[model samples]
Target: MKQYELNTIPDEGYRQALASLLYQLADDDFILAYRGSEWLGLAPHIEEDVAFSSINQDTMGHASMIYELLASLGEGTEDELAHGRPPEERRNAIILEEVNGPGDYLIEPRYDWAFAVVRHYFYTVAKKVRMDSLKQSSYGPLAEAAVKINTELYYHLLHWQTWFTQLMNAGGEAKQRMEDAVSRVCDDFLGVLTLGPDGESMSRYGLIEEEAILASRWTEALKKPFDSTGVQHPPVIRSLRGDGRKGEHTGDLTDALHTLSEVYRLEASGTW
Candidate 1:
């Protein structure tokens, strides 16, 4: 029931909580999208390559939307927030910040397709869960942004869900690889579900559903596929690496930021 617009938020504490949440949302999508793009020519097939590229584009656009909302609240311009921040200042979940697989994209690049599919599928589902709750967020701009972003999620979810389920059902090496990837993803999955220290105020302010509620919803959503696929249900997700909401990150994020900001830093401003 509590609702607020861009500049109409009731207090600085609320703004801080809102900013923290927005940064998490924006940073998660931004980095994940970049990882998706790395699969540009490396996907299983040409059609899928195109489809994945489009999905990453949409995901990056969603990040831009939230970054703009943050800028409206005096955080910084969208580009600056996307490109200027150091790794420790980022708020994305550690799992989402993880690289697709070993080897550089342009080098020998021994990437793991199973890991890429698993990671994207899990992250996309989490994004959907949050977007559903955010549609009724206390902040007006954020709620509206959620409404806009939610429309594209159906296709995103379907795409990943299909990939996840099909691979799990295939059996043999495909199934084994997916199982390994699932375990790896589950290890740090809690990073995706947590709301960090500001969680209490964020929930109390009605910005979005509480972290536990949203986490429960995400677990429930995955039940259908996990049940049908025969993969052992990972009941409890934990963050073995670190909690990214608190700005704790691995070297993967540091390297990612370097690559992500290289072009932006070269051309800091628009020119004719």
Candidate 2:
């Protein structure tokens, strides 16, 4: 398979598809990392606060790396790509951009731990599947990024999986909360499973595998945890209309970007 270097990509169609894919990848991590950052000092305990902070930093770094790749492709400077995009231009999954819970991150945040664990766990598994396939991507930079990302993902997946399993087996209100979280996650989870409108071209160009194949892998990967914890597979809602890939987003994303970009917006001309 031919590996496409920065300028070696074959045609206009391939560039557009690859750029779309890059935006999706970058925006997903960028938005979710921002969400994760909200847990700082608010995690269940001090240890988790520290550990979760580290994880959020790593995730945001990954987003930055991808933004640089996009910059190489002439999209914009990495800062602009990361901080300048509007809600409609963001390509993250709808689930990733949703609020961590209700209320503000500051001043009496009634965030739900169950939702955080479930969302991160499920998203991590899906990301692992995607990254695994991306390791073989024909786009050299993306494949390279996938390889580097898998290192942190190893710890990330372990962390979330442990939280997920332990919570589900707690067998009380904890278990019930986790199950409810699973249902809510499943509602928009499909957003992460598909590659959006560019899915066909992405596969054709060998950027990554098709959505069906990736989704199948995600399902299979979750079987072990589900089986061990005796949690049945929650039905994934396929009718979700707020698919973020197509720029369909709720006010959640608007509010998130507002907060996230506040500092960057203050100094748009500054470097990252």
Candidate 3:
């Protein structure tokens, strides 16, 4: 059987654990992509808006694949799984849900491009590390999915890293803005790194690599370019807000969920 091939019912404990990991992956990408979609047509520039949308689409596509995996496991229909779930049930990090800035997407957004770049770039790198680890996961289907997902991430990582490097080296108001944005993103980065309460079990089962190892690798991967450009890397990253893997979230997620699921919610019980 193909590595990415669907399984009817996983009788083994490893398969069940794999399913849970996949759910977390799907949920995280779904929520974050929804936030990214909100930024559409509202970015600082036209070029950036186009580039940003591509990344959002890629993320949503990844989420869709995960949802399909869940569907195969009889979790629920993909549409229902995505749109019908309440905020408290969401598993995305609080940082992914945070508002772009002080205003609605339809209004004068007053969004911060610096924050967007920092958050997306950092998240992309962190995700790359995680995905690389997953490519070697014990679960065959997930390992295959990781290999496939990692293919598109090359562009996503480059796109954000370019923005991060350029802005940090811009040497003016841009640098100050980016610096401030970095501080804000780091405050909640741990939320993205956490693998929930079952992290140890996941690692023990070889479902995914150790979180600390992944986090350190992420730090190292980001540090080289940052050091070359003289951008200061934070001594340590902490989730000052809270952990999202534990189902803790923020108001931003509440608003974003409403927007993304609006049409879906209109006919929650009906097929769209």
Q: TM-scores across all candidates?
A: 0.96, 0.96, 0.90
Cα RMSD for candidate 1? 1.7
Give a tens-digit lDDT track for model 3, residues 100-215.
86566446656788998888898899889989999887667778788999999999999989999998999999999988888888888888888887787778778798888988
Count of steric clashes across candidates, in order: 0, 0, 0
Question: Against the true structure, candidate 1 has what lDDT?
Answer: 0.90
Ranking by lDDT: 2, 1, 3
Where model 1 places Cα greater than 4 Å from the true spot, the runs are 103-108
lDDT tens digits by residue: candidate 1, 1-272: 96888768899999999999999999999999998898899899999999999999999999999999998988888889999899999999998877788666446556788998889999888999999999999999999999999999899999999999999999999999999988888899999999999999999999989999999888889999999997667455889987899999988889899998888889978420
Instruction: In model 1, state the lDDT of residue 71.
Output: 87
Model 2 residue runs over 4 Å out of place are 103-108, 239-241
Better of 1 and 3 by TM-score: 1
RMSD, candidate 3, Å:
2.7
